[model samples]
Target: MTVVMVEEIDPSSADAGVPAHFGDPVKEQRLLETAVGLVDRSNRDVLAVPGDERASWLHTLTTQHLSGISADQGSELLVLSPHGHVEQHAFVTDDGTTAWLDTEPGAGAGLLKYLEMMRFFTRVEPRDATSEIAVLSLVGPAAAELLPELAEPRIGAVPGPKFAAGSVPPEATAIYSVRPFEGGLARRVPLGVDLLVPRAAKTSVIEKLGVPRAGLSAYEAIRVAARVPRLGHETDHKTLPAEADFMAAAVHLDKGCYRGQETVARVHHLGRPPRRLVLLHLDGIATDHPPAQGTPVELDGRAVGFVGTGVRHHELGMIALAVLKRNVADDARLTVGESTAAIDV
Candidate 1:
């Protein structure tokens, strides 16, 4: 089990009010627009599943079609409860003997626990390998340029399940490619060997490559814009996969049976989803004040649903993603907590 906590980088120290997790928001904003930026996501968890039956075991469990996943390809999988709520979202990459599951920052424990419990009947071995592997996200338009300079197997836009492997400067192995997101581009590099580069070298890498450092706040904004439903934000044990937009990205309709497959198939075939995920544009000055999750979303004196994630956009005003009743009108004027917002559909 490898676990490492990264030192926080103070955003205020930078002129752009960037948070510590993301070095400089100003630079990050620039990188988002023009160049690429590196975000150290080492805090996320990486689970390693190794064994002869790893592929079949995972195939029988998760949502994606794991049988077709080759050694060089990767797929996003959603682990859901029998009730159809998301338990964990993972990026699974196979290297024949081992399958690496990269999960969000706080989801490692739960995923590992579930994997362990399920392993009783299978030959798969699940190990927490987050610390042993570091995740560096290179985002924005110029990310493709930086990948070729790093290692062999040039980065290319391969459809589902394909990734490129390469070597980084100072002897580091990197997996660089654009992962599937709602609407934007994201380049991920998982460091294979620990180089233990000095802080100066890391800074130089960022500067020379023109990769901006991002924080959680910037990530939040980017996620909202991309309409990517995160585990904590748009998903829960009470929420179904159909309501969280996972059906469009992670869920497979014709794949072999897996846990929660019945509910997903039934919902999609019937088109009877209880709720729909919709984006909202708040109708007031942007502020840090956001409606609490599960706060009622009222439309025309009727209860619709509730807010999921809310953010104050620099230009787009206050925008949010909400789970509302399927019957709610797209143009409905809704009240999120005490704030008023229009449904962006």
Candidate 2:
């Protein structure tokens, strides 16, 4: 049987907007936890870097140590400003010739421009590949079983930059699969693979996969519960990698000189980041909508932080991610709008 598609599907997805759910949000969440769940991430932007020097070029641009990233390997990179503030975030995988990058919506243009401006004498060429490719995230207990090679590769899960290409739709030239890291909050969420396929073959591939399609409503709730920080939500131009807890995953402390290396080193060695990410447990007794993003978080009437993404977790009730002052105690009582909340670092 073929997987059914929504009749009036929104291609741009502007009609449904974010947090759009198909079925019961809780049920969809459970689907991701127990079985396979498919999430259409076409709303995300993609950039393709094609050239002989793509890997070395990007290696010097971002914090990840890309020299070790051979074929079928990948890494998450953070583009920082000269002051060591996170300006962009992307997951990168290289196919020897082309470096494929997946970034948050509306962030591709800026990244492309930055890459172009700094292309003094490098042989790399970066182009927007959003129209050429589409992204689908498959997650659940069965995900590894569905894509065995991606989960358990023969060479012992190539450490540096893990990526693989496989057959999907005939029209789709390649299916790039990335394995999620097993650390941090990822340990609490279901392990999965992120598939990047040709734009024209997205529907065919999804239908052939025969999995329930989950929407942002289910994804956002689980993302908050897992304490995973997104680009637009928990990060901005002023956010630093260390402050977002991305130091271990995205930044390299011992790498050669990069644009923001000075600031990163200074912050890491002596100065502490003023703000840090925390999970907020919102008071469920409130009869109104949970605190919106950017809501002020106060400690005993003094503003201490700002709320990021707030969602109703199926099991955890109303919870949110917040960027709070480092001085704030982990058990501090916080007030958001007319509601009360507790902090978890």
Candidate 3:
């Protein structure tokens, strides 16, 4: 589906070779919200931590607790700089033996280095699995109901009100049909299922799934609407995950002793984050495109922050996720480049 979608894209509709949408972003988003929509996220990367103690070892290194994570259960984790700035984001799952870490494209190597560097006497062996794995997504009201067709190999889950993606593979879909794919619970995007399919079978699997295809544009629009921050987009090297509202999905304040935990604790217990994530309603009537990401966001003629992902949605028109000084008021009117925007309520 990805190969087919990208081949015939309008020159203005793509970025990094992925189409923003297949000409009708509005329809695509509506499908994602109402029917089933498939998205190509093979651009992501994965690492396999196969060892007898992979879970417990990762427990000490990352923000998510993994000491006794059950098979197919999953959670999101953050690898922060010692200063508590966000460095890496991993969607983690354990299939009883090996723990799989899925992350954004080009991030597996750094995460693998971190994992390997911390392995002193622990029996963990980490390897980049990008050559063998790819990620795709199914989202919408019908997403779970269609799991029966793609249930051969699956991955784990994510946390929720308590800071972990809530559904495990078996429970995410009551199908146990022996499909061997890795997955993580999408914490920010509701009712979404990510499939870590074997690279060798990707084309075939996509061809077999009978759903309308959504481009990266539709996906980004919905993500922005949900206010989920994508790593490397909403975060800079100095970003605190807390500033992007990652605490509800990635951070576990009670799990002490992890790297960067002290800083997280201090900030969580004593001080407010210096920055915060906000949803922006872009001026769609005046401009077809929202300001480019990383565009300076201004308020009262002063640069306050930067924009993240911006997209045109079927229901919401133009919207973007942005990071701003914590002092910015919720009702503040801001500007991204020359485009006017307001903090979404």
Give the alpha-carbon lDDT of every model. Answer: 0.61, 0.70, 0.73
Q: Can you write out model 2's per-residue Cα lDDT over 275-309, one digit (the tens) per residue?
A: 99999888877644667778888999999888888
Model 2 earns a TM-score of 0.83
Question: What's the CA error at residue 14 for candidate 1, in Å?
Answer: 23
CA-RMSD of model 2:
8.5
Give one digit per residue, the lDDT tens place, for model 3 in 154-217: 3232233234332322132111222344333222124477776777877787788767788877
Q: State, as a TM-score between 0 and 1, how close model 3 is to the true structure.
A: 0.85
lDDT of 3 at 208: 80
**Which regions in candidate 1 have their CA more than 4 angstroms from the true location?**
1-27, 148-210, 286-288
lDDT of 2: 0.70
Tens digits of per-residue lDDT, candidate 1, 1-345, equal 121113333222211322334434444555554665555544567888988888778877887656545555455778888866778888766655778787777789999998898887788889988666545466565655654433322222212222122211111011233332222123343311111122334445446545446654555555676677877767656788778877644666656577788887777767668998888887765444656556778987778887777765555667788888988888777887667888774
Instruction: Give the worst 10-residue stretch by lDDT in candidate 1.
Output: 165-174
Candidate with more favorable, higher lDDT: 1 or 2: 2
**Model 2: residues with Cα > 4 Å off, grouped in runs:** 1-19, 152-191
- Model 2 worst lDDT window (10 residues): 181-190
Clashes per prediction? 10, 5, 14
Model 1: number of backbone collisions: 10
- Output the number of the TM-score-best candidate: 3
